[model samples]
Target: MKTILAILAGATLALAATAAPAQTLKSVKDRGELLCGVSKGLQGFSAPDASGKWTGFDVDVCRALAAAIFNDPNKVSFVPLTADERFPALKDGKIDVLSRNSTWTLEREAKLGLLFTAINYYDGQGFLVRDARKVTSALELDKSKVCVQAGTTAESTTKDYFAANSMALELVTLPTSGDLVKAYEDGKCDTITTDVSQLYALRLTMAKPADHIVLPDVISKEPLGPVVRQGDDQWFNLVKWTIFAMINAEELGVATNTLDAAVKSQKPEVKRLVGTEGNYGEQLGVSNDFVVRIVKAVGNYGESFERNVGAASKLGIPRGINQLWSMGGILYAPPVR
Candidate 1:
């Protein structure tokens, strides 16, 4: 009887230890800025302009987080990381969150001790070839050299795709996105493969963007989003809901331009979202007007998409399935209430 009681007490203590609240939110508040990991330099996703001001879809996610926590969008220090360096950096406490266009996968979450907040961008793997090659389909690239970033899902996905189709492949794996682009541009490889959105962004860096084309064939589902380390439920919830709030704001037609009107809306959902009706933000460890701060900083998800990589921007990628659920896409978020 004594032994059984001791074992039961040990089990309870272990469970309590495992369920301890994560200190990431408090750490960010103490540090006075968020340490955000981003891609080395993926245009329209996370890149610094000539002025060194970071602006892109991924960059805006971190900025919105900063706004939600500090009420200042600029309270974030962007740390550029390569495909191989991203996870280790986040796992080692080098960054508070990673928003570098990383694909959310089971292995990454379970094996790497990381957690993806939400699918901020729905993407798929695709091929990019110079128009001069006249390659209209990825299936035609048999025996061709493919340039892909090493340590990325693209590397493995490309290999599996070719093997599955019984096509010959000569893969030129590089260490960074820039290296892959340079290799392709220098004729070291016949084509490059990555997320379709990245292909579009990379094309803009070429000498003649019009000379490259992203093939219509999509090979893999790449649900990209911000990632936080595991064991920090508080931080995870904050990050997850920050994205959800932006998505929900878009669905509710509460963009930055319409945010003031949303605050005055009598609708229960809008009131809860704008923090006039409930303590949802308090529940998340942020100010009651957290959603408003996010919208004011980065606008809604659609607004950020349009401004960075969508039709309104140079990338000109269509909304396609990234559109709001009610607007014919899969982008749906839970209500604030």
Candidate 2:
């Protein structure tokens, strides 16, 4: 009986070890294309052009993952999801990864059984108002009607901020970002509140983009990043490290423009990043040159940022805190070594 029990236990252990890679990665590999959840139509983060081509910062993250996995950035299906639908889609296995600009909060992970991989954008709650309103600060708008998207941290944060400051707030809560913007444009509210990054994006959609101004006051911390389902350590690590690889590439000055030289780099960190020195990508269940694939597809984090939402883009938002740690921002990644 003792021999039989020992043999059964060993068999159980073997099965567990075999299942260690988790189902998400295997399913993605089998499907031949990654299902990435993105915002419904947030320009600069994730939006479909007139030709139905998706492009933006968040879209690039999904493309980077596809490039890492399939060596083809185009091997991805972008699923547009609303704020309320995003989490459920991810939880229901409708999407493999959520690259929507979602805020990372404790309640989301602990309550929803999801995991935020990493904070790709550091943001804050801010207000946007028509420049003609003559309001330069969020605190100055007393008894103002504020438009915010429902089912988002922005709605709750706006409420808390108003109450804390002893200001009267007429809240106009909308179901989607489009609704919020429409409400704001239709004079349904005196101001709109959301993440500072989002506010910039929203402003661009206005009839006269220069007529509105994003307030300088940042009320709450909003660390936005990619999210994956919990319990899939392999998938979680892969997504997290994918973002890290982008950040590290930017720090190492290895971008899409310099990718050819990066492959032959002899620097210890550069070698590991370019896959000439170590098997870091293989350990993540991808090709050893996964970083090369990612960089080639989306350039690096900074490149994606500048191209989609930074000064080079229509938004013209400053790099601010999203810059690399060495360049006075909090953006830092673990060494590939």
Candidate 3:
């Protein structure tokens, strides 16, 4: 009797654990809004224009997830957050998923009890300095002060690079990226260090964009992506597959412009990705054409990247490692089936 009762208790606890709020995809639909945690303001990443419509690479992730669940990409409310507040916000269930440029680290995953769904950006740490400073290599900044944001990959990367070469450098730990930029511009630090993608974004805020240059040396890998609190397998699957669908869509040549034609094809991967082959969406508690909606509503991964941070945009970030496997970079998706 004691053993039976223990098994029953354990089963009850397991059931209760999985019954958290996000399980109700219907609640999100009824509420008519998906609360998303994102950067307060990072151009070409997640920032609202003057018209108040949130636009950027991260916005598309939130929008795509919203479209998958609610069938409306616009049914999302952006919750601006800082680097420090990102994980806490998601863990507390304040936001469904964190869409910030959060790096996936073992410490954050195991210690914080979170999971990285997919990498939206494969980047690395770099330093940016005034063009007039004329410092070409990071190795030359021996005694320079670098403006770094606290509680981010920047801090550890900066420390690692400096220690590895026995280079002596002053550290200026700023509270936020905005503060980091301000401090750098104020001459509080000779250089500001961050992801190479962001270094370009940061330069756009300067008075003279031509006055600064991003160093060519990329110090550390920054595989940035969305994060979800642990124990929500259903929610994790939705977020994870949504990203996969986008990538798979691109690989299968299913773009908004050619979506109509691509949908008619009997290709296994295309059909599975666009929701024509299987009831993949039903498994995720979303509409049958969830992947289709994501592709049509926002765009595939390549389109989103090009629109926000590619050569056409102000940031002009080349899709070096973020490109698809066929194109030579590491970006690839598992079989949709």
Candidate 4:
């Protein structure tokens, strides 16, 4: 009898452990809003407008997730976090998802106990320098003082690149991107270093946007993506597929204006995505029309890209590696079927 009781107790403990991680979905549903972490203000990526309404690339992801779960894209509370505060907020459950422009690295996942959902934006580290310097390459910035945000991979990457290239570097680390911008604009640093996509955003904030130019050298690959806490497979899968759905929708030629036609699409893939065929969304613990909700709310991935960070926006960053694989870029997604 004693042995049987011990076995039963152990089984119950195992079951509890399995169920613990799945609580994120239920918790989110009960709260009726998705708490999304974002940068304080990164212009085209994640920032508030004049009316205090958030709008940007990262903000759309949070809205898409909300639409998938609640069928209302606006059912999201954006929590702006600095570089140092992002991970802690996510780990402590202050935010359901980290939609900030954070890079994916081995240390972040293994050491920090976080899971990067997917690379929503393919980026590379580059330098931004005043055009007056006439510097066209990162190699030209030897011995230059670079402003970088503290607690970001950019800081280490800058150090590594400078050291590896046998060049001297003076790093001015600030607690936030805003501070980094100020330091650079105030002439405290000769150059500013970060992902090239971010350089465009930062340049726009300068006193003279056209006076600074992004260098041609991409020192490191920084695949920026959404992140979530580890140990919650259910929650992780939801976010992962939410991004994938947008990408897949774009691949299928679906867009916000074309959503009605997509609903009537006779293609097998379209049928599956629009919930006329298999119940893929239901398998992921959402309504069968989850993709439809996302598309209606945020449009497809391509639409979001063009609207927020691509040619349609002020950044005007080209869709180089971010283009769909069929169009010579590598933005491919798994099939819904």
Candidate numbers sorted by lDDT from highest down: 1, 2, 4, 3
Using lDDT as the measure, which candidate wins?
A: 1
- The per-residue C-alpha lDDT of model 2 at residue 147 equals 92
lDDT per residue (tens digit) for residues 20-111 in model 1: 97799999999999999999899899999999999999999999999999999999999999999999999999999999999999999999
Candidate 4 worst ten-residue window by lDDT = 17-26
Give the Å error, residue 125, model 3.
Answer: 0.7
TM-score of model 1 vs. true structure: 0.97
* Residue ranges of candidate 2 with Cα displaced over 4 Å: 1-21
TM-score of each: 0.97, 0.95, 0.95, 0.97
In the range 33-136, model 3's lDDT, one tens digit per residue, is 88899998999999999998899998999999999987889889999999889899888878888999989999999999899998878989999998897899
- lDDT of candidate 4? 0.93
Candidate 3 global TM-score: 0.95
* CA lDDT of each prediction against the hidden true structure: 0.94, 0.93, 0.89, 0.93
User: What lDDT would candidate 2 get against the real structure?
Assistant: 0.93
Evaluate residue 260 in candidate 2 and report its C-alpha lDDT on the 0 to 100 scale.
Answer: 93
lDDT tens string, model 4, 1-337? 9999999999999999876774788899999999999999999999999999999999999999999999999999999999999999999989999999999999999999999999999999999998999987888888999999888899888999999999999999999878888999888998999899989998999888999899889999999899999988999999999999999999988888888998898999899988889989988889999999999998999999999999999999999999999999999888898
